[model samples]
Each structure stands twice: as C-alpha cells, then as structure tokens.
Target: MRTLIRGMLEFLRMTVLLLFFMGIIGQLENSVVKMIIGREGYDGFRFGGNFMFLIGDLLLFMVFYRNYLQFRGWYTEEAERLPKRVTRMMLGFGFACILLPITIALIL
Candidate 1:
C-alpha cells in the first residue's frame, strides 16, 4: 500500500512537471515572436517559433504521459531495480517543464 501511494505520487509529480514544461515552451515561443516582431517588422518569425513550440510541447506531453501510464500502478520489482537516478531525472524533467514557461514569461 505504501508503494502504491508512492507510485501514484510520482506519476502526479511527473504529469505536473510535463505541463509546466509545456508552459515554458509557450513562453519561449512568445518571446521569440516578440523579439522578431520588434526587430524585423515581420510576422513570420512568430508563426514559425510558435509552430516549433507546439511540436515540442506535444512531444514532451506524449513522453510524459507514457511514463505516467507506465508507472501509474504499484511499483513492480522491476521498477524497484531501476536506478534511483532514473527517477530523479524524471523528477528533474518535470521541474524543468514547470520552470521553463515561467522563466520565459518573465524574461519576455
């Protein structure tokens, strides 16, 4: 039961992290668009940057979703055998996802 709770917590943490990362990518795209518009007086940069950001966001979402699905249940013996660093990395990625958007928004 404790292991199950831990796994669920990890899954939630990962999902939140992924959402946060998506937000960061959005902010970055916004910044790039703002810059391009300010300097070049052209709208193409905004469109291209946004498009790329969308793609990246989608890809990250899929990856994180997959991870969530894979780990949603109780921890398996195999999962326990997995390196601690792998879990830490998953957590780190989630943290990055959350911060990136805020950072970009603030900078822009």
Candidate 2:
C-alpha cells in the first residue's frame, strides 16, 4: 500500500540521517583527540574538521525535526486508519537510533 511504502521511505531517510550524524560526530571526536595528542602542530586542520562536524550536526538536527513534524502531520491526517505495524516500525527505528550508536561507540 502507499502508506507502507511511504513509511519505508521515511525510515530509510531517517536512518541515513542518523548515519550521517554519527559519522560526523565520530570524525570530529577523532580529529580532536588526535590534535590533543599532537599538541598545537595541526591547529588549522583542527578547525576545518570541527567546523564540518558542526555543520553536519546542525543539518542533522534540522532534518530530524522536520521528519518529526512530518510524521506528526501524517499521523494526524490518518489517525483513524493508521496501521499498527507502522507504529511498531517507528518505535523500532527510534530504539535503534538510540541504541545502535551507543553500542558502536562502546565497541569501537
């Protein structure tokens, strides 16, 4: 159905955003840690990495907020006929969003 397809697409979009944000955070943390270890030898490069991460983080938050709004709009529009499976998928995505990164960070 159209709703199922839309839900899948939205889930994919959110997953991509989450991956992007995680990548940026990981890269920034690595860069800062390396710079700290190296003292002030590469301070200029440090700014570039930090700036990139900041931009990515900002964009990620914006996209996430927009997605949340859209989800709410869709739910409101289809409140009576919304599929239970769609709700489960959304909850599962949320749990993955929270747990996956923590697991990766801890393992790495």
| Worst ten in a row by lDDT for model 1 | 39-48
lDDT for predicted candidate 2 compared with the true structure: 0.51
Residue-level lDDT of model 1, residues 1-108, one tens digit each, is: 887787787678766767787777667655664664444312343324444445556655655555554455444444432345665565556555444543454456
TM-score against truth, every candidate = 0.41, 0.38
Alpha-carbon shift of residue 58 in model 2 (angstroms):
15
Q: Candidate 1 at residue 66, lDDT? A: 53
Poorly placed runs, candidate 2 (over 4 Å): 38-108
Scored by CA lDDT, what does every candidate get? 0.54, 0.51
Model 1 ranges off by over 4 Å: 38-52, 60-108
